[model samples]
Target: MQMNDQRDINAPRAEVWAALLSADVLKECVPGAQEVTGSPEEGFEATVVQKVGPVKATFKGQVSLTDMVEGESLTLSGEGKGGAAGFAKGEAKVRLEDIPDGTRLIYDVEAKVGGKLAQLGSRLIDGFAKKMADQFFENFQSVVEGPADEGSEVAEAEGTDEASKKKGWFGRLKG
Candidate 1:
């Protein structure tokens, strides 16, 4: 599956970058994120509960940032295993640009699932992935454009946090 997203943040490029990479912000933004272990400056380990149709599983995974070009762009890759449910791997390239209003955050993502999970079909997986991505960006926008608090403050530089909303990864995944 593939996806793309863009958000206009009211903060500066530096601030947007910081908030986007913060561990606290990511933990809050990412759907079903249980714990974020490691640094957003680099990456981290995560456990997330995901579901599709009648299938449900908790996934243990690692996410990392690679092919970085300072404030220009970066490549992030990760994989998750849901025990009996199946496994999935994905990569996304994010780019930052200065816009008339603020910083424009853009991303292109691609993902693949295997095992019994793959049998669920592509439309399901694709829809699920898009939903997850939307959730993350939505939270990011709220934080970056709203206020600057301890959690909402920028991470390495430009950043923010997704409120106290505890996300449940429950829904039929579209592929």
Candidate 2:
């Protein structure tokens, strides 16, 4: 499947570019991402658990950044193995532009599946891929823009632990 989208983020292009290269930020934005580690120069290794239609699987993958043009644009490519469930691979071409509001983040993505995942039909796979991409960008925007609600500050003032803060973050994302 293939898709393209764009979002205007309320932050500087440099900040957005830095966040794109941060594993911690990527881990938080990705749905079901349990862990993400590595540097931009080498690559990143990730573990993600996901459900598509009737199949659920844990995917182990490696993502690499290439053709980076400083704070402007870059290409991201990754592949994951899900054992019996199937394998998934994709590439995303991302570009950043300076906008009066902040920064405009644009992306074009193409993905493919094999094994059992390929049997799920293009419609289902396409829908799932679109949802995932949307969710990731939404999450990234939220993170870059800071807390979405005043309750987060209240929680922090109330001395909420790190775990509680994370839980609240996820709750807000879902809501």
Candidate 3:
């Protein structure tokens, strides 16, 4: 499957680029991501849990950044195995452009699934994929913008930790 999207963040392009490369930010933004280790330069290893339709599984994967052009753009590629549930592999090309409001993050992704996951209908998988992507971006945007008030700051900090513990993975195919 293929997906493309763009979002405007209320932050400078440099700040958005830094956040994208930060393991801490990725851990918080990626849906269902339980743990993320390593850095952009060294690559990252993560464990994620996800449920699509009737299939639910845990995936361990490695993602590496390639074709980087400083703060402008980069490509991330990775693959994961979910035992009997299935396997997924994909790459995403992310581009950051300066916008009047802040930064516009545009991403194009291509992904494939195998094993049991391949047996599901395309419509089901597509819907699930879209939903996962939406959730990921929404969480990411919230993290980038941060809390608007001091009182909410404390709550946001505590909530991020709790949310990470409860969530599972970015998506079946996202690396």
42-70, model 1: which lDDT tens digit per residue?
58888988787678889999999888887
Q: Candidate 2 regions off by >4 Å?
A: 149-175
- Candidate 3 — which residues are off by over 4 angstroms? 150-175
Kindly report the root-mean-square deviation of model 2 from the true structure over all alpha carbons: 6.3
Model 1 weakest 10-residue run by lDDT? 166-175
lDDT of 2 at 68: 97
Clashes of 3: 4
Q: lDDT of each structure?
A: 0.77, 0.89, 0.79
lDDT accuracy of residue 142 in candidate 1: 76
Candidate 3 vs. true structure, TM-score:
0.82
TM-score for each model = 0.79, 0.85, 0.82
**How far in Å is the alpha carbon of 13 misplaced in model 3?**
0.7
Candidate ordering by TM-score (highest first): 2, 3, 1
Model 2 Cα lDDT, one tens digit per residue, 1-175: 9999999987788878988998988999989999999999999999999999999999999999999999999999999999999999999999999999889999999999988989999999999999999999999998876665567677778787642543323334444
Candidate 3 at residue 20, lDDT?
Answer: 77
Native-referenced Cα lDDT, model 1: 0.77
